[model samples]
Target chain A: MKPTTSDADENSPDLLLFRYVEGDLDAAQVQELEARLASDAALRDELAFWKESFAEPEAYDTAHLEKSLLVPVEPRWTGSYFGTWIFILTLTVTLFRPVPVAMETRPVLIPAPVSTPAVADVVTEARNPEEAITRSRMTRITLPFREKRLPETIEVERNVNESIIPAPIPGIKSRPPEVLSPVAQLPLTGIKVQKVKPKPKPIAVARTLSRRQGRAIMRMKEKARQQRKADQFLKGNVPYVVPLNSENF
Target chain B: MRTFLKAGLVWSGILLSFACYGQVIPLGALPMQYNPAFAGEAGGPRFNFNLGLLTASRFRHNEYNLNTSYDQFIPAIRSGVGFSAGYFTSSFPYSSSSEGYKFSVAVAPKFSLKGKYTISPSLDLTYGSSATSWNPRPGTAKPLNLSGYHLLSRAAVLINSRKWYIGYSVDIPLHNTYQYYRYRLFGRSDISPERFNSYWQFGYTFQRSSESKFSFTPQLVFLTGTDRYNRYSRNSFRYFAPEAFSLNFRYGKFIWGANNAGFHLGMQTERVRVMVSNGFGRRGLVTSDGLGSDAYTGNLSFRYMLKQSRW
Candidate 1:
């Protein structure tokens, strides 16, 4: 074996041992040495002599470094040979253990999501519209509402049709600039114009809408409360009927 | 009996990695999910032979922050080139050729003693083609493909004694990635970062290999980066994670690790699991102009490390 280009093992009996530990030997030569050393005695002595040459830091030979570590030995290394062999054997097994087998086709790959699919469905969640209207009224005095207008071709546009007075009695619109007051020029609001009311009272249609919205909100809240109770019941004491099992625990 | 055999098989797989020649082959499809923060960086031979299999595959989330590379997982295998992910099955059986050759090396040859410190430095290298592809989903708007050659390496230190396990590793061009993800969407191939950088991983490890062939290693790693010239990470030197650790396990030739960091998690299963696993990438706090560069990251890989050295 060849010594490494390092000095960590210098002066130690194993100084050159690391050289062999380094992979300086060819496969063919290692095999040849394994067979020859098992039989040849004199050659083994020569091998040991060379091996002992670098036993300490006194000498570092390149020939041994580049060549084989299995030269014939005289009296083969007896300096705890058994222990070193065991360690080497153990290391060899650890390094050479067969890796697990892999086939071409692998198992199914399952994807994991950070956010469950249910989460992205927020905007489309099941909702009680009636409850939403009631909550909106309670939360803020002002709403982010835009002006609504009835289309010219339609009359049931709740916003536009319920605004001010209707267009001049069909055709007679001959009012001068100073003739009519600003209030009188405005379109009439409500089903019929009031002759002289103190202030505009709530429209019947609006009152009806308010009532419906309130009821819807109350029902939504009640439903939510019931759902909570049902969930708790399921989790706390989930009772089950025994099925077709022969044995009982 | 199956458990023991599985353990033995994994152990043998790990041992088979030590041949001085030939290609860099992983012991099994799975190997220890390692972090430079805890592993000794001195490049010698780190053996895991006789360790049992980590039956728990490296099935991990592709969340980068939740976990480190040690927590990624290998995909389950069947035959040929077909694979199943979730409910989707894709196979490229027409050309059963490999993406490309991969080369991996781990060298940690220190057995010497330091003053009051048992120091072991190791070097690890991995470079190969990715075995998976990144498809452009609807409106993703990406062009970074994880194709072509990738290289990652580290030189690190592991100092340990009776009570504690401390480690540090300096990563070099170890994770040189040449990705081409989501190219069609962007109308151009993805570009590789021309800069080089080094990352350091420091952590505590609990290794329990005593006298048995099977052992478990749990470690917590703190990672930091320096020298912006490397340019892998856009941010300056910093560290995060009050609770980011990796649990690496070995059984025979099989090894696995799982890590969770913040909201991201990852897993790494090697050898018998044969993979370069980096999947399940979820959106993080960071936003990008494109999905390819933002979605694809380096993580949870299963690789074969082949090594040879001269004394």
Candidate 2:
């Protein structure tokens, strides 16, 4: 719908004045109309109606007064200027929202090297009764540990926010991505936070080997068992952005 | 630090006073009317330094106000002091001369309507003495030694998104002089409004960002003005009335595309300047020695402009 002047105020003086304001008109009718505004009471009343239409908006019809001001005049929510206004408001709020830029600093994930045999992709199938109960217990215990450590790991990470490394400082060279866990959290400690060492996965050799060889395999098994014990040992939950800052690499 | 800070304040005040002097002419007393909300409040005193030569773009911020420019950044209107020096070379029809070491008092105010259009009016009150030597030297004419000031007060309006603008600009002659050859007056100063000619301009900002500075503005400007200027020669006779055309280019702070009249080329920072541009008037269907030669000038400046910053 086209918004025109008189449609808003049928007796507006500003509207009346706008048309005659420009150009030289020799029309006798225009001359008579100008002369009439001075003497006629009804014309004065009508002109007063025009002036007060905007000036004394509380005295007039709300709809007509609103139309005159040319404000948020559109009615529907989905279409028209109202929609545009909503979009602008939403965009402004969204753009200015504090973006907690720390999210951009995801710790450079130097993923732990997995034992080739231990990490085989498993297919989902109906499980044996004994295995199912054990697996359910394992998941219940493991899930909480994973969820709890995430935040702690993230907080300790240093270079997680930036994606690309900055231009190499001319005098300085870059080293490969490495984790630097806290010195206090060495292997001798019972702490079980995962480390990201690039050790090859241990292969299951037959147990017929000598005691020295068995001890190596046993040590790997010993470490895995210690991890499980610590997993159960953790009492509270914390999400982590773990890196060299939090653990051994 | 205290002495440097004081100098900076004094310098900024000088530039600000000169800037307001220029703005007051066009706006008529709006720059100083204190707002009740800001009556006792003091805001953004900034200090920025630019390496004055090309290939040295390392700029330091807030040297004068102790890093106040970033956190205490002002909007449109800012108060601060700066010192700049630059050189310019002018090439006139008869000969070419190089004018160096220009100093300026700068002011910039940007006004805007929310989410729509932005208006920035800035002034540069500059004084530069000349180093000029005429070519085919005129007879008994004292060397056109223009040892005075050049003031350029400009108002610019820009759109927030559409990149369109309409501006009203007036270049007022300050405490300056020109050994204007009769022919050069028509070629130098256009007929100004209020005895100073005005140029109504329309422009489009095609390229923009931090590094671009003035390099980003590609404007189509129309210049029209007149003064009684006569170019009578033993070889040819020419008269100056009013010349008008749409000049298109990227203009830096001081220079527009090459001109000889007063415009010289001095590069401090930024691009597309009308350097003390000498030899830049394109002759219309008329000829001197029947040679349609327009001396296009390009000057390099010593004073570098700070980045086109948002205060």
Candidate 3:
């Protein structure tokens, strides 16, 4: 049926009729809708049809409806055993492959050692005895002896006069001159000469120090030992002493 | 319908071209793989499997990788385990080519915060072996065989919301020993051990969801790490060091399908500088004449969700 007003308009008579039936219109609009409904047979018929159609439907069998609307689902690849096996096999093969060895050639270089010349002034002065006695200022000799070992003896030749020989000093042990090719008498001057005992292999000795130096070295060694013991105890490597209980014992 | 067919044809052509160009390996870890907190944040029990092929510009071969994960959300806990496997071949112009394979497993647990935010932390353990066949030299009768096994580990954290995510991760080497076997003399020699190295990554992801057809994710990644060395006797070779600043940008698209299944296509570009220590303390890039190099990668991923009723 043709309507009096366009359906697109919100204020159309058709919408007003529905609102009137729903009791949503105000008093004046309801009165106007009622007057229009009374005048128009088509409006009365549309309203009656609308009321019938909008009424609640009768009971129906939902069991059949439920069965007809099921959604189709495809099986997933991950659901299969073969897919799982493929993943496992891939992981196993990738992690267990054989490793390779690397090789390369590299050059090695070795360095040479350097040499120094020996000093000659000390060797020449020891050979002249007349000059040595004139310059005798109690020179001391210090041998390089290993721990607890006796120092080797060295012999020095002298003129027959005993006073000409240097006196022995403390901590510097000196051996008596041994006569090699027994004392030779000079024909005119009546002077006696003795051969040095091959210079006693020419022992290499350093300059000497006093007896207090030896005592200082011993004290330093004792201090170092005590420090080592204290360190060991602090490091828990040695047991520390604890006071024992006593009754004025 | 004609437009749809044309788009399909174009995508197929692009895929064919990419396949011919070999694989493009992602230089850094993906957010889902590195972050535990991002697990199962999509609001369902889901399974994901992805396969990727990566090729680098400096290397002539392709690398193939496969990853799978399954996660479920419960009132009490959110947990998932992931497995990944990869095989790669690398060739140098003047040196012998090498092939390697690796397998990794990750365990991730997620904790929900305030029903909107999630925190996931994960640990990954990986093992792999590689072999290099030496080139024949004038004095050598046969090629020397060089092989090695390596173990790697990663610890990561991710904090994510429905639309954004932030994550950090550290990847380190656990075992760095290699062995060399001389075939002619039947002698074996051990190479210098590799030193501890850590590769770190900080990333942010932004997601834009679509109602029906497509979704998009844009990500920014910052990568940095210290120098790593391989020691032989008293000499050491520095292999890789982090650049002062490096960044990666990734754009990903998701095309939806029936029953929550979708195809994910992503493209990423990265520029990084690696300090490589040659013998005698010299350091530079092996791939580039300059100090840094650029890498481009593409990824295609697929996911299928089995709904509760179907399960």
Q: For model 3, how does the per-residue alpha-carbon lDDT over B209-289 read when each residue is reduced to its tens digit?
A: 211122233343444443323222444444443321112222222121110011222221111111100110001111222
Model 1, B213-254: lDDT tens per residue?
343555454445432323244654444432234444545444
* Least well predicted 10-residue stretch by lDDT in candidate 2 chain B: B21-30
Question: RMSD to the native, candidate 2?
Answer: 45.3
Ranking by lDDT: 3, 1, 2
* Chain A of model 3 scored by TM-score: 0.23
Report the TM-score measured on chain A for model 2: 0.17
- Cα lDDT for residue B131, model 3? 83
Residues A1-249, candidate 2: write the lDDT tens digits. Answer: 423564757445545543344323348746765887777778767656544432111122334655787677456666667779988888666555443333222233232322222222221222254353233223221111211112222234454344443577787765544554566234343334688889786797545878877767666774565344334323212111000000000
Per-residue lDDT tens digits for candidate 1, residues A122-218, read: 2211345435323332322332333323233423546746665345676687678578899877666555645885777667645345867876766
Q: Best by lDDT, which number? A: 3
Give the better candidate number (1 or 3) by TM-score.
3
lDDT (Cα atoms) of all candidates against the true structure: 0.35, 0.33, 0.44
lDDT of 3: 0.44
Q: Please provide, for model 3 over A205-228, each residue's C-alpha lDDT reduced to its tens digit, 9 standing for 90 to 100.
A: 766767788657655774565455
DockQ numbers for every candidate? 0.00, 0.01, 0.00
Off by over 4 Å in 3: A1-249, B1-19, B22-24, B27-33, B36-77, B91-95, B136-141, B178-217, B228-299, B303-311
